[model samples]
Target: MANQSSRYPILCASFNQDNSGFAISTKDGFKIIDSNTGRLCYDRAVGAFIIVEMLYSSSLLAIVGAGEQPSLSPRRLCLFNTTTGAPLREMTFLTSILAVRLNRKRLVVVLQEKTYIYDSNSLSMLDTIDTVPNLKGLCAFSPSLEGCFLALPASTAKGAVLVYNVMELQLHCEIDAHRSPLAAIALSSNGKYIATASEQGTIIRVHLVSEATKSYSFRRGTCPSTIFSLSFAPSLQLPDILVATSSSGSVHIFSLGFETNQRTKMSGSFLGSILPYSVNDALDPAHHHVLHNAVSAGVRSYAVVRKVDKVADSSSSEIASCRSVLGCVLASELYLFIYFCVPFYLPYLYVRLPCPLPPFFYLLTSARS
Candidate 1:
């Protein structure tokens, strides 16, 4: 199944830091789309590309090729300027680049065994960290300078993560999150919190950066599944919620700060009635809500918490309302689905992108703010 889907026309897709826009690379070339208007902002038909990352709403882009053409090698990274339609600078590496992340202050490039950090303004090499063999280039980064931290797997045998202070250029701490190797990791916008999911995908753990010994554990399910992504709500304090997408084609929302037991008891909503309430809820099933069959099971899906609001009710104390956009690629077609909810109501689809997307594609969302 993996090999067959690899032949899809669209190779990669990713949103910018703000989640206001997204870019996709394909066999024909690449294109950038505005999230608000769903308008094609930029299109280039030069060659096939494997990665196309945008810097916020600017004209600057970091792109890498699929190695189909000689000049468009996977080892070469190009800083492209859409305004001038020219390459500002290019960097070549020894091996294929697995992933690239950018913010206003820094640029990060991840290879199989090493990760490089560079000053985004001067393109000067800052530091390199030798990592355990990361074929998937598993890492998490926060773009905010105040909470700017980079997380990398400390060990391949277990879910130990090394958190580095990118701004200070020093090692922060290591967190042993899971018993098994990690499958997905996410960092909050302010860089104060980190979340991890092991290969088992049944339990997700959130850790405070300063206190690695303490963590908030959430049970996803009893049966193991593959977790594709994890995201935290954008906040200066502890995020109120966390979102996760898995191979089960279900999107899971876990309330971090909400009083689920009290809310479940007081509300008459449908979600409240069905939830199993207990005075001593160990797993806290009331706080965990799932949108079943959100996409086709086994299909790759990505979602992000774009914006969250606090609604004060005359009847209730407060309700944490959230809005998010999700994109999923099933077989040869690309589909975008938008979902948001207040309280425990099930998310309803709000928008679907016009069909017949460039064939063979994958979806990505801004993991942080």
Candidate 2:
């Protein structure tokens, strides 16, 4: 019998400080690969356990995971020097880490119901926030780092979303979002929009900070099964692009836009979907039945970043060229019996590009004054 529940490999990956390269956690160990060359720069065995989650802070890399055997001991979170793969610090807790993120100044870790903030330099716990209400999923922090937002399902009702302010540790607002639990949440690079996916595989969008007095919502698309993840484009030219991976090994993308009157609104224009060839199908033609299991169990992850370069302006060819570039990244993997049988696999797909244009530029152009 085929398993109805969808399961994809959850890889742990981090972007380099320059956003030029990426480090991915694999079954054998960890590897640092060149983004352009696709060549392995470094590969070493960390241990026998599969990494659960990872975060990059400056030159530091942190990984969290439990041992091969399932026990009551908490997952071990280890910090390492990315350049040499040297262990820096290791912390253990009874609760497993659900999410991990790093900003310029701090490393934030979200466990089951609590959030831990740590100093980027010392790796010491700076503060712990305990009162977050039923944190369903966490999204990227705002560009200013003033606050982080979370998606919470309505406790009493069916379709509801509760947005929380991480800094203030308060409920900012609530939206009657979807009929099912949220699968993933993503914040726009500009921090002006928020996108969410539900268990039923519906994508919805909302305005982060409003300029008008009204609120708005938009539908991105529906998935064949539950959506496991969501991401937005890093380029400023793109408002927000939504991506969702389904149980049937299909990936979908949506171009998102906003509509506003007195309230803000969201609309998801369907972009397209991709169904890549299964690895087993390419490797072994004799074992076709196994190919279905391989693809169905394979875990897929997606991320986007912007690449900018000066291009000659068509209207003013004599003048210096202006900036023009496009960015994208998408990857998937199947963890069959390959050398190692690590308990949990963490696969991450990351795209790195130059820093985007400042927010003030957009604000100035959109301002009414």
Candidate 3:
């Protein structure tokens, strides 16, 4: 799921549950870097790795190897502590572990057809979910303890989703999202909303987790494109914005709050004529902002909305006094670009770091205010 077409030296990359820090796995070893200061927090020189997931800012890490060496098998998962530089525990599976997600309460390990849930503290097996064949391991997990829901593809034929409560260990609901199979999925910070994109990738839908129905739909493009990533702005209530990266090399920003507040007011205006809403509220083009050529076409890329800022603007009375400041990291074979953009305002490049080798994946830390 990290990269589809090109091969990068870095095997795997992932952020911690809260996105405060990220870990990268390379042929030589893996390293954890702080998202705030760009400091190297920890590094391990063992071998190549396929998955390296951190648990928040803690020293605990769940790592899977690339199967290059016998000790670092792809089917083996090691829970290692960075402070001691030694593994605390290990779990072997029948097949390769595709992905691992951790939070304060649960540990989720995903395989091609099965997903295992465990208690984080005691490491006791909690429950197991048998799912359809998921080669890419496409899923979304909300780390919030109150509404810690896990979303997985419900069907291989279409883009249906099954949302399960990880805390209560039961089924929540199912959402028939798209006719085509899903390409990417993401949950809101508080687990109130979930966003999905299908293989067609022409449209992205945002759904209410409780209702399990489409709440808002945004058009990605007229032509079919692959959605590399989808992220919701962190919020306890309804998130104001959602960000998406696509194979067409554009970073799309959808303003949900503005759309909601202005929908009634603009429905009878000229803006509504150009972008009319259907029964499902397919939003207008004005609300959809795109950053063109953010990454190389067809190269794997990921982006996240690290933070959103609200500022008072007396001159603008029709619009709300808020701005979505999106922090995105665009990576290709050569370098990683960390930049910020204010929708309807300006885009700014903060940091551009050249990679020692091709970076396979990268993630941004969330600063929830």
What C-alpha lDDT, on a 0 to 100 scale, does residue 155 get in candidate 3? 97
lDDT string, candidate 2, 76-180, tens digits: 667767676677877777676666666556666767667777766777776676534444434445433554554444433344555555445556776655577
Each prediction's RMSD to truth: 6.0, 14.1, 4.7
- For model 3, residues 1-369, the per-residue Cα lDDT tens digits are 335423435577666665566776667888887765556788778899999988889989999999999999999999999999889999999999988888889999999999999999999999999999999988899999988999999999999999999999999999999999999999987898999999999999999998887778888888999998888777743337888888888888887876686678777787665675652256467567777776778766767766677655577645463465556554534235455555454443323344332343333222322
Candidate number that wins on lDDT, 1 or 2: 1
User: After aligning candidate 1 to the native by TM-score, how far in Å is the CA of 25 from where it should be?
Assistant: 1.7
Q: Which pairs clash in the backbone of model 1?
A: 8-360, 9-360, 10-360
Task: Determine which window of 10 residues in candidate 1 has minimal summed lDDT.
Answer: 324-333
- What TM-score does each of the candidates earn? 0.82, 0.60, 0.87
Candidate number achieving the greatest lDDT relative to the actual structure: 3
Each candidate's number of clashing pairs is 3, 18, 0
- Candidate 1 Cα errors over 4 Å, as ranges: 1-8, 236-239, 259-282, 313-369
What Cα-based lDDT does every candidate model obtain? 0.75, 0.44, 0.78
